[model samples]
Each structure stands twice: as C-alpha cells, then as structure tokens.
Target: MKERWELMDDSKIVQLYWDRNEQALTATSDKYGNYCITIAKNILGNKEDAEECVNDTYMRAWNSLPPHRPNILSTYLGKITRNLSFNLYKRNTADKRGGGEVPVVLDEIVDLVSDTDDVEKEIDRRELVKAIDDFLGKLPADKRSIFICRYWYFDSISNIASRFGMTNNYVSVLLNRLRLKLHNYLLERGFEI
Candidate 1:
C-alpha cells in the first residue's frame, strides 16, 4: 500500500529500483518528490516548470539506476533536479535575465572563476570536480554544509540562515569567506581562475 511504501527507508527504496520494481518509482516520489520540487522551483521560479523538471529527474534516475547506484539517494536526486532545473531555466531565460535567488548566488561566485572563452583554458571537468571535492573535504563541517546548501541546493541566504540559526548577514559573510578560500585554493592548485 502507499502508506507502507512511504515507510520504507532510502536503502530499501533504492533496492526496489535496482530490482526494477514498479513500486520503486512510487517510493522515490514519496521520499524525494517534494525535495526535488523545491530545488527545481528555486531555480526555475515556476511551479509548472519545477514539476516538469522533477518528473524528468525521476525518468533520468530510472534509466540510469542500472549502471549507477548512488550512495546517498537524496544528494543524487537533488543534483539531478538542480541540473535539470538549471538547464530549463537557462533555455527559458535566453531572451531575458533570470530574476531570483539563483541570480544572486551566481553573481556571488562569478568572480571566483573566470569564464572560459578560450578552449585552451578549459580544464577537464573531472579534474576540476576533484579539486573542488578536495577543497570541500578540508573545510569545517558547518562551513562545508553551508557552502553545499548555498551552491549545490541554490538555497537563499535567508533560508540558509533560518535553517542554521544564524543571522542573514552572518551567513552571507561566511559564504563570502568560503568563496575567497576556494579561489585561493584553486589558484594554488594551478587552476586558471
């Protein structure tokens, strides 16, 4: 029943997906649907677009599960929702500018790394990701979580402040400091920032 499926833990739900059971989809939606919708809505700024992105995320997960088993289901789902929402937001805003917390977040980090107009300056995405991962690993837990929440989840400063019980200005300051640290770290690692 629906209630029973809702009671299942993440690992069980993931197993159902691995087994190709139809109920896996239901369980995933039950567990992560709202979370995905929130991520999509934050980026796309429309309920309809968010819903579409969430649905697409489900489809993407279904297709990719056979070859990919995520250790953290929520993080995996959130990443998919965020990426899909970003792509949709980009296409919709091609004629205009995006208005929301998304723009604020982007503007804050835009200076950390310069735009790669020349193909020669483009680093392999995997290497860049590895460097970023190493940097995050070295950060204190609270700072790392704040950074992930702000950038990875596209969460607004006010929302992050509320969640972490910090003042909005404090959260903003922390994020700025983290960005500066990341920029210096990347530069020391020979990244073209």
Candidate 2:
C-alpha cells in the first residue's frame, strides 16, 4: 500500500512547495527518494553517500522551487540528483583512485567527451545537447537504449547485456560502435572533436 504522500501527483507536490508546506518534502521524498538514491548509488557506489546526495537534492529542489516550477518534476529532480552525485564522486575521488562502475563508465565514454576546458564547456552547451539528442533520435532503438543505459544510467556492461538479452561482449562491442557513431555525429555538427 502506498502512503498518502506517495499518492499525490507531481503537480500537487510542486504546488505544495509553492504553497510553502513542509509536507512537500515528505511527499517528494516518498515519491522519488529511492529513484534518486539509486541514481546516486550507481554513480558513487556507496549507500551512505547516495542517501546524503538525495537529501541534498531535496534541499536544492526546495530552494529552487516557489520561483522555478519545473515542467517535469522527476527530470528536474533527477538532473539535480545526478549533478550532485557526480560532484560528490569527483570530490571523493580527487586525491584517491575512484572506485566502482562510474570510472569504468567514464572510461568507456572517454572518446566521446572532450577533455580540454574549452571543449568541455562546448560539450555542456545547449547546442551540443541538441545535436546529441538528434543523433540519439536517429539511432536504432536498441542502440539508443544501450547508449543511454551505459552513459546516462551508468549500468554495467553485464547488467545492460542481461537487460537486453545480449552477450556481454556483444554489448561492449555495440557500445564502442555507438560511441564512434556519436563522436562522428557531433563532429559533423561543427562541434570540436
């Protein structure tokens, strides 16, 4: 059975925030806490840090709301959670070797992401996002899913293979091909390599 807070729709929850109701936090947590935590844990590979990131996400959401009402609440919260988790992961790994699938995931996409500061800024630019989105849109559904699973969700190769019923090697090879295609796609759109 779902709790009452869990039953409230996202609009109502957003309204609760706008209304200055503290129950807003409870409702948002009940609804998306686990989702955010999974995203955090996937990136950080630590249960405790994941939970902290989710909590910080709520705080950030609360602060950002009442003035900025997101069109898609889940995506908004998710972006916040993902960004916070990555920041935490960077901080935790700065002086030491980073653990878990995140570094592996990053390594796999190394060719796709730019390393130079200017190129990095270019990657974050909205036009680059649209180009990537366009490229993903043109890809076959399975390939797109593979790319999103490995990069966006940071799923391990074996896990992604299990999800898609492919051999792990097949998934790895497919991901490599997809990355090359995306790299070319971005380059063709006038983005810095």
- lDDT, candidate 1, equals 0.85
Candidate 1, 73-174: lDDT as tens digits: 999999998999988888888958454568888898887665565664455455678989999999999999999988988888888999999999999889
Error of 2 at 167 (Å): 3.2
Q: What is the C-alpha lDDT of each candidate?
A: 0.85, 0.86
Best by TM-score: 1
Error of 1 at 36 (Å): 0.9
Can you write out model 2's per-residue Cα lDDT over 97-176, one digit (the tens) per residue?
A: 44557989877767665646687586567777888899999988989988888888777888899999999999999988
What is the TM-score (0 to 1) of candidate 2?
Answer: 0.87
Model 2 accuracy (lDDT, Cα): 0.86
> Model 2: runs farther than 4 Å from truth?
1-3, 115-124
Backbone clashes in model 2, listed as residue pairs: none
